[model samples]
Target: MIFTSERLVVKTITEAHKKEFVELLTAEEIITAIPQQRPSEEDINVKFEKAIGFDGDISKNPLNIFGVFEEGEDELIGLVAFLTNDDGDRELGYRFRKPYWGKGYATEITKRMIDYSFSELKLDKITADVWVENVASNKVLSKFLKPTKEFYNEYDNCTDRRYTLLKEDWN
Candidate 1:
């Protein structure tokens, strides 16, 4: 397992998770919150490859995606990632299936990931960027990260807000 919280287990995505991964990528709410376009087959395939390729050693790889599942369950409900930004800073990201929403999984897994990043990975700080219209995600991120800036993303054509949390500021 990559990590675990009280109610969730995270692990590197594998072939067993392909169907659910595709479901997540095609979910309407997920599509709206992210790129806001239907994922092409190529897009889905590329992301699946990256998710499965994660080495489970973020300090060395610096970019990895993992599958999130409820403890005692085989269904893959979501994905969380630690990505390297253009400035070489670690960034946090997550997405859950619609049925999994409103159940505190996002907040739970996010907090766990942040703790892991700070304490285990030894990262000084972690960052996140959220689409302005994704209120639920913005709320989840704001709980742990300080809003640093907002800017227009040409690729997604939306105003995005960036947040940061430093190890020194963690409780």
Candidate 2:
């Protein structure tokens, strides 16, 4: 496992998880919140490839995607990613299955990820972006990251907000 919280285990995605990962990405609620994860088969395949390719060393391969499973459960309940943006900042992103929403999993795992990013990875800063309409995600992010700005996201055709957390600012 890459990391674990009290009730969840975040680990590198593998071929065995390709099916669950695809289902999580294709859920209607997830698509509604983040339209970027289109349901097309090709896009799903590409995402699966990217996820399984993560080698657990973000410095060498900055694009890392991991499956989030409940403790002692084999099924993947969600996925989280840490990737280097164009500006070379480590950006955090996550999505959970519909059933997993409202269960405090996002906040719990996100807090752990933030701590890991700072302590283990030793990143200078971690950034995230969320659609303004995604209230839950915005709330989760606000708990650990300071809001930087809001702007129109042409690619997603919606207003989005950016947030960042510096290592020095972490508790």
Tell me each candidate's TM-score: 0.94, 0.93
Whole-model Cα lDDT per candidate? 0.89, 0.86
Q: How would you encode candidate 2's per-residue C-alpha lDDT over 2-40 as one tens digit per residue?
A: 899989999877899887898787777787887554668
- Each candidate structure's count of clashing pairs: 0, 0
lDDT of 1 by residue, 54-125 (tens): 755777766677899999998999999888876688999999999999999999999999999998889899
